[model samples]
Target: MVIDTATTSGDTALKQKVSSLMSTLKSDLCDLVRIRSTAGGATTEAANKVVSLLKEAGVSDATTVKIGSGRAPLVHGTVTGRTGKPTVLLYAHYDVQPAGSWNETEAFTPTEVNGRLRGRGAADDKSGIMMHVGALRAFDKNPPVNLEILIEGEEESGTGSLEEYLAKPENKDRFKADAYVVADTGGIAVGRPALTATLRGIAQADVTVRTLDAPVHSGMYGGPAPDAFMALTRILATLHDDKGDVAVEGLLSKPWTGADHPDETTYRQNAGVRCGVPLIGTGSVAQRLYFKPSINVTGLDGAPPPVHKSLNALQSEATARVSIRLVPGQKPADAVAALRRHIDQHRPWFLPVEVTYAGGGEGFEARTGSTTFAKAQAALQEAYGQAPTTLGQGGSIPLVNLLQARKPDAPVLLWGCEEPAARIHAPGESVHLDELERMTLAQALFLKALSQQ
Candidate 1:
C-alpha cells in the first residue's frame, strides 16, 4: 500500500499500456454490449454510453450523475492525481438485472459465447465497467488513483442514485478516498482468489391473514369455518422454533466469525439441495448466509387450498411475504418492529392479524482494519495467483449502506462482475473468460496499489 502516481512514470510504457488497452477492450466490450441496460428505466441509453465512456476515458470531468427520478444515471467522472497523490473511488454499476426469455432476439444481442461475453450488464456490471476502462486505458487515461469513476444506474434497482448521488455536500470533499475498487466478485474456484470483506443488511416484513367477510363455505363452513387458509398455516408454523431457528421476537443473531462456507455436499450442488432436503439450519454457509438474521416466508397469497371453492359464504384471507437479512448493527426499522411483535403476539386462532411493511437495506460489516483492506489483499493475491479468501455477501448493497451511512469512515469495498454462478438475473447469464482475466488483473493491481499508497 504505497503509491505516488505519476501514472508510474512509463517503465516499458506500462507493459505497452496493458497491450494497447486490450485492443480497446474488444471494441469497448462490444460497445457496452449493445445496451439493454435492463431493469426499469432502461438506464438512460446505457447511461449515455457510460457518459461517453467517461469522456473518452480522459475524464476531464464526465457527466450524467442525476438524482432520484432518472432511475439509472450516476455516471459522474473526474481526474487529478499527480500533485500530492492519494485518491481512488472507482465504484461500479450501470444498471442491469432484468432480461428474461428473449423468444426472438434482443436481450441486447452481442453474444460471443466461446470467449465469454453476453448481455444484460455483462457479468453484473459491464464487466466491472470494462475493467475501469481497461485500467484507465492502461494508464494512458492516466489512472493510478486520484480518479473517481463512480458509475451507477441504480445497482440493479436499489442503489438508485446511490443515496442521492452520495449526498452532495460537494461530494464530501470530492469523494476523498484511499481505496475502493469493486471489480465485481468471483474466484472461489476457477483460478480461485476472492476478497469480499463483508456485506449483510436488510429486513423486510409482509404478513396478512383475515377470517370472515367474503368467500367461505368449504363444504358449508368446513368444520366451523373461520379459516384463513388454516390461519396462514398456523402463522407459518409459529415462525420456526423447534430447531428451525427464527422465532422472530427481536430479530438479530451472531457467531459467524467471517467466511468459511461450502460444505453440505458443496451445498447440494451449489444450492439445488433436493433429495432428503436438509441444508437449512446449521453453522457456516457463511454462518446462515452471511452473518445471521434470516427469515424468509417469501410469499403466500390466499384461497385455493388445493381446489374446492364453494362460492361466497363470507370471507377468509391469508397472505405472507416476510423477508429479512439484516446484520450490520441491525435496525431495519427495528427488525420491522420485531416482526410486528411476533405476529401480534401469535394469536393465529383469534384471527384478525395484518402486518405490512416491506423495504429495507442497511447491512455491511466491512471494517477489517483498513488501508484499503490491505491493498485489496495484495490486489487479490496478484490477480488470482492464490491467497485471497474472505467472504460474507448475503446480498445487500443498498448503495453500500448508503455510502456507509454517509462516510462512517469511508473505505467501502465490495466485489462484483457476477459470480454465484453468473446466473445473475438468470438464463445463461454467463461471465467466465478466465474470470474476466482475473478481474482485469484485480482491477489493475488495485489501481496500481492505490496509486502508490
Candidate 2:
C-alpha cells in the first residue's frame, strides 16, 4: 500500500534540475549502451566510458582496478561534500549479459521508440550506471552527501573482485558509507517506486539417467526396453505436484507480505502463458514468486531434435540441468542436498541417476524499519509521489550478499528504473525515459536526505 504525500519544496527544485539533464542523459545512455560490456566482451572500453562519464559529472579520483587475471576492471570514483555530512556509496555495473538473438531489433543500437530506449543493457544496468551519473549531475557535481561511486565491470559474470577490493586494508575506507545504494534492481512498475528488501539465491545440479549402455531397437524391444529420455522426464515431472508447487521437501516458503502481487491474468499476459493453461503454483503471485523456492529445468542433453529423430531407436543416456532459486533463510548447501534427496526418493521404477552439484550462493534478507530505510522511503515518496513499496526480487545478486556481510552497519538500498516490461537481459530490452528521470531525482533526494542526519 502507498501513502500519498503532497509535493515538497525540495522536490520542486529537483524536478527542474532533472528535467534539464534529460537530453544529455538520453544521449549519454545511448552511447554507453552501444559499448559491448558483456561478460568476456570489451569490458575495457566500457570501463573507460564509465570513468569518462564520472569525470564529466565532477567526480574526483576516478580510476579502474583490475584484480586477478580474466577479471574485468572495476571503475572507482568519488565526490566529496561537507566533512560532517553523511557519505553514500553508489553501486552499479557496466557489464551486461550477452545479447541473445535479436529477432527484429538490433542489439547495442540504442533505438528510441515511443518514450522507451531499446538496446542491450538499456535497463538491467546501463540505465543504472547512468542513474548515478544523472543524479550526480543534478547536484552540480557537489552533492550534499559525500558520494563514493563503484561501477563494476564483471557483475554479470560474478567475478567477486569488488568484494575483494573492499576487504583490503587500504581500500577499507573507500566504501565506508552511512548507506549503500545499488541501482541494479527495479520498481514494481514503470512509474511506481519500490525498494527490494530481499533477494533469492540459487542452487544448481546436473542429473543424468542411463538405462542401458547402448541404444536398443524399439521395433524389437519396444515394450520391454526403457527409454532414458522418458525416465528423465518422469523424474522431472515429479518435481512439481498437480498444483505446480515445488514438491521438494524441506525447502523454505515464507509468504510475501509486501505490495500486492500481480494477479493471475497479469502474470499470464507477461509470461505469455498459453490460453487455458493454468498458472504454476498456488497463492498470491508475490508469495509463490518471492517467498518460495523455485526449480527451473535450464538445459537438456542427449535430447534428439525433431529433424534428427530416429523412431526405431531408444536412447541409452539422458541428462538435465536443474536450477533452484532459494528463498531467504535457506542455505545453498542445504537446498542442494535437499534437492538430491528428493530426486533420489522420487525417481520412477527405482531407476539409478547421477546427481552432480554445482557451486551456489546464499540469499539475502534486509532489515527494515531502520533510519536509512526511512530516509529512502521519504526520498522515493518525494520523487514518485507515493510511499515506496517493500519488495523481494526473484533474482539474486551474489555481490549483494557479500556486501551485506562486509558492511553490516550500513543499510543497502535497491531501487532502479527497470520494470517488468523492460525485458532486461533479453532481446528488445528497453527502459522508459520517464522512469529513469524519476529514479534520478529520487537518488538525488536520497543523498540529500541522508546528509541531513
Candidate 3:
C-alpha cells in the first residue's frame, strides 16, 4: 500500500513536513485535551483556543462566531490557496462528553503513556481538532486546496448550532466547500484507517410505570402486590426476544455490506464482556450492532445503588431511561413511534404505562462512488501505508445529515485519529499518537489530491 505520491512532488513533500512536526503535534493535542470543554462546561474557552491555534498554525483569517453570549461559539477560518483550486472544509468538534472519573490521570489533565495520550477529549475530538491543524500546518497554512475550518462547539450535545449557522444565506458562501472532511470518526484499529460510510441515529424515552398508590410491605403482600418495578422489568423484557434480537414491531434491520466487522472476540474484548458470557443478538456482530435496531436501559431511577440497603417494601412507581439506536434508512421519529407502540402492546398486567419521547437525530449514509471519495481513498491509503477500509458508525452524527441535506453535491469523508482502544465517552479515554499523525498526513494528501482535480 505504498502511497502513489511519486508523481506529485508537493504531496510527497507534505508528508515529510507532517513527520517533522510530531513534537509540536503532541504538544498541541495535549493542550487541546487539557481544556474542560464538556457540554456544560466552558466550551467557549476551548473554541477560542482552537481559533487562536488555527491562527498560529497559518490560518490568517481565524475568528470565532457566536450565536449568543452564553453559547459556545464556533471557530471559523480559512487559508487561501492557488486560484481556481477546490476548497476543502475540515470539520471537528471541541465539546466533549462528560468525564465521570479518571484511571491513570485526571480527565482534564492529559497524560502520555506508552505512545498514548489519556484524557477526556483526547481522542473523541480534541485530537480531531489537532489533526486538522497538523494537516494545515503541513502545507504551511495554505493547503493545495483552499482550506476552511469549521470546528463546532456543541456537537456532542446535538444542538445543531453549526448546522443552523451554515444554513443562513450569508454564511453559506463563507463555509461552502467542494468536499467536507469530518474528523470526528475513528479508524477500525490503530494504524488501520477507515472511512465511515454511515452513521446510526438514536432515539430515547423516559418510561414510567405506576401499579400502586403507595408502597406495600413485602411480608404482607409479597405475592399479591403489583410492584411497579416488576411490571416495568417485564415490559422491558419484551423489547428483546429469546434470541436477543430487538422485538419491537416496525423497526428495521439489514445486512452490512461494507468494511470488515469486528470479530466476536474483538467485540467482546472491546465491550469488556465477562468470560463465558454469550454475546447477545443475532447475525454477525456488525450486522446486529450497525445495521439493526438495538434497545438499552441506560438508566434506572428509584433503585438502590447496591451500596445502600433498603429491601423491605415494594415500590409503587419506577422510571427507566430507554435508548434506541436506529440503523441507516430508519427514521428516528418512526423508530420512536414504533417503540411507543411496542410498549403499549406489552403493558405487563395491564399496568399504566407512560412513555415520553425524548429528542433524536437522523442517521447518515455516505455515497462511496463519488470523485472526492476516490481521492479520500487514495489519501488514506497513502497515509496508512495500507488500503483503507469502508465502515459505518453505530453512533449518530446528526450534523453529517444536515451537511448532506444542505450540500448534497459535496462528498463527506469521515476519518480520524481514534481507535476502539481509545475508550471514548468512558473512563480512560485516550488517543494513539501514531493514528493522530497519520491522519494529519492523510488530510494533507487528500487536500492535494482534490486540488489537482
Candidate 4:
C-alpha cells in the first residue's frame, strides 16, 4: 500500500496511495516471514533481521531484552514524538507455533499465491507485526504521536514473560503510553471486519485419582476393587452437565451480547470439522466460548496400557489435565479454588483425588464508547465498505490487560492482518492481500483520525 507522500490530505486520497504500494508491502513483509521465533533458549537469526528492520524504520530506541532462562528475547522499539500528543504502544508476538512435517511445503519458505501469503508467521503474527511497520512507514516512520512497539517471542509455549518485562522498573517506565494497540486479532472472515473487545481468561489444573497401589489382575479382584481410571473418568464426566455447561460452582456464567456468531457451516469451514458432528451446547457461540467457563480435558496418565498385548489389568493411579476458560469478570485464582473444591466434593466412591493448580490468567473486557473505538470503527467500515462486527476473542494476550492497568486514561484498540480462514496455529497459515491492504488503509486512516483528535 502506498502512503501519500503529502500530508493533511483527504482519507480517500490516502487510501488510493496505500493501495498502490502493494509490491513494497509484500517485499518488506517477506523479510519478517522468513524468521523462526518460537519461545526457547536460542535467538533466531531471522528475528535479528526483524530487529534491523525496526531500526531502519526510525525506531530510535530498539533493543532485545531477555526474559528468564529458556525464554526468547522480547524485541522492543520506542520513538518519542511531540510531547503534547498521546503515546501508543503496539503489542505483537514474533514467535510462532512449531511447524510440523511438510513433504513438499517447507516450514521456513514463505509463499504467495492467489493474493494470499502462506507460511508459519504470515498470519499468526509476523505480518501483523509488519502492519505495525507499514503503518509507521506510511506515516514516515514517525507519526504525530509517541509510540512504543513490543514484539514478543514466547507466545506459543504459553509461558509469557512480556508481562514480566513490562513490569521491570526500567522498561516499565519507558513503556507507558496513553493507548495500546494490540494488532493480534483476526477479521471475522475474509473481508469481514471485526474488533475483539473481550477475551476469556484461562486456568489449568491436574486432577489425579489413586484407588490402588498397583495393577491388580481383573480375574482376582475385578468386581470389588475400585478402578482408578473409571473413577477419574466419572469425576471428569461431572465437569460438564448434559447440556454441556460447566458444572463447577462460583466460576461465573453470563449471557453474551457482543455479536452474532457465524453459523455452523462457517465454523466447520474455518475449523475443518471433518467429522460432521455439530458443535456441543445450545447457547450462543460467544456465550459458550467467551463469557462462560469451559472445562477441557488436556491430558491423561495411567490405567491404560501401552500398545502391547499385555494381560495386566487396570489398578493404580489416574491423572487428567483440566483447563478452564473463565469469563471477563472472574479471577483465575478464584476459579482455580472453586474448581479444586468442586472436584474434591464430587469424587467417586470415596476415592482419594488430588487437584493441583498449573497456570492461569485473568480475562478482559473493554468499553466501546471511547474516542479511539469510534475512530477505529469508522475507519474499518469506511475502508471495507461494510459494517464492523464487534466481538470477543476466545484466547488471552496477557500483556494487553497489564497495559490497561498501567495506562488507564487511554483506550486500547485491537485490529490486525489475520482472518479466520488463515488456518492460524496450523499448517498453511496464510494472509490475504486484500485484507492486508484494507487493514493498511484502516490503520492509516485511524492513525490520522486519532492524530486529529
Best by TM-score: 3
Local accuracy of candidate 1 as per-residue lDDT tens digits, 1-453? 441222334433544555556656756766776676766745788888888887777886788866766656678788875676766678777777666574214555657677666666677778788778777766667776577778877766554456654666766655656555566656555566676767677766678877777675567777677778677777778877876767787877778875576556765775566888776565667787777777787667874644464454434776777788877778788998988888778876666787777777778777757776777766666555566777777777766655555556767777755666665665556666557656665666676766665
In terms of TM-score, how similar is model 1 to the real structure? 0.35
Stretches off by above 4 angstroms in model 2 are 1-10, 158-174, 210-227, 306-316
Quote the lDDT for 78 in model 1: 80
TM-score of each: 0.35, 0.90, 0.92, 0.88
In Å, residue 332's CA in model 3 sits off its true spot by 0.7
Q: Least lDDT summed over 10 consecutive residues: which range in candidate 3?
A: 1-10
Q: What ranges in model 4 sit over 4 Å off?
A: 1-13, 41-43, 100-105, 167-174, 211-228, 274-276, 301-315
The local distance difference test score of each candidate is: 0.69, 0.84, 0.83, 0.77
Tens digits of per-residue lDDT for model 4 on 148-237? Answer: 888877776777566666567776565677778888887898899998888888888889988888888878888889888988999999
Compared with the true structure, model 3 gives a TM-score of 0.92
lDDT of 1: 0.69
Residue-level error in angstroms, candidate 2, position 371: 2.1
lDDT of 1 at 49: 86
